[model samples]
Target: MAAHNHIPLPIGQVPSSPYYIHPSDMNSMQFVSNKFKDEGFTDWKRSMTISLSTKNKLGFVTGIINKPNLQYASYKQWERCNDMIISWIMYNLDAMIARSVLYFNIAAEIWKDLEDRYDSIDAFFTKMKMLWDELHLQSYSKDFQTTTRSEANAVLDEAQ
Candidate 1:
């Protein structure tokens, strides 16, 4: 009987390493089912993060795995991972939003830009909600109600 020996590989060669690209991983792959529109940035981000983390590629966008210097041997591996991450992000984004970050070279930079842009959107929505609530509260209610469409139209005609 022959005994099999298992050899341990370096982190770079391990499947769990961010630098290690699985044969199945491709640039055209869509990580999330729902494409991110201009709104719902928070939910979109969460979905993307989960998908990336599952692939063991979360560090590329999170900036935890820093890219090596251009001259370094590992630089190419890092760049490939970064590009793949960017592709996944772009695939899940709306066309307009994707174009806005298309020129970005680094995955982390794209992530940061998206975060900054969406934060402003969140603030705008917050302000609009507050205004809506205030307006709703200030609106007056009448005791008499018009039950039919014609009655409502008559009331509107009277106002005119």
Candidate 2:
């Protein structure tokens, strides 16, 4: 056989590798200070994504680095990394939200559930805007007084 060109670095040694779990990466480590509180999912997701990316563990939740089979040598390491990622995710979630997903064993599954349940800010804003437009349309009647540009300017000056 030809010489092997690739040699796997020892565990926790390859900072760039997805499977490399840093010694400081504990299950109790909180990736972000703000917990996801069933709202502001976009901001919460962005913060967690940046933190996980920095640790090279984003793939765990993104489903890029899948869990290996039990017979594989890296299976145990994968479990450790997956569990750690799950714990980090759980820690960043609000108590109720975390408990909702507590039974999920896969990091990706928990991420998907959270995304499905709460990641709809864009749609929510769109719906709110539509409702506001509808309300504005409905609130206007022929009986209402219409202010001209000068009248609006006068009102602004008075407020100032």
The lDDT values for all models are 0.81, 0.82
RMSD of each: 8.9, 9.0
TM-scores, in order shown? 0.74, 0.74
Best by lDDT: 2
Q: Over the stretch 39-143, how does candidate 1's per-residue lDDT look in tens digits?
A: 888788888899898899888888898888999878888988888888989988999999999999999999999999996787677666775574455454442
| Candidate 1: residue 116 Cα off by (Å) | 1.1
Regions more than 4 Å wrong, model 1: 1-12, 134-160
Instruction: Name the regions of candidate 2 deviating beyond 4 angstroms.
Output: 1-8, 129-160
Q: Considering summed lDDT, which 10 consecutive residues are worst modelled in model 1?
A: 138-147
Could you tell me which 10 consecutive residues in candidate 2 have the lowest summed lDDT?
151-160
In candidate 2 the C-alpha lDDT for residue 93 amounts to 91
Please give the lDDT score for candidate 2: 0.82
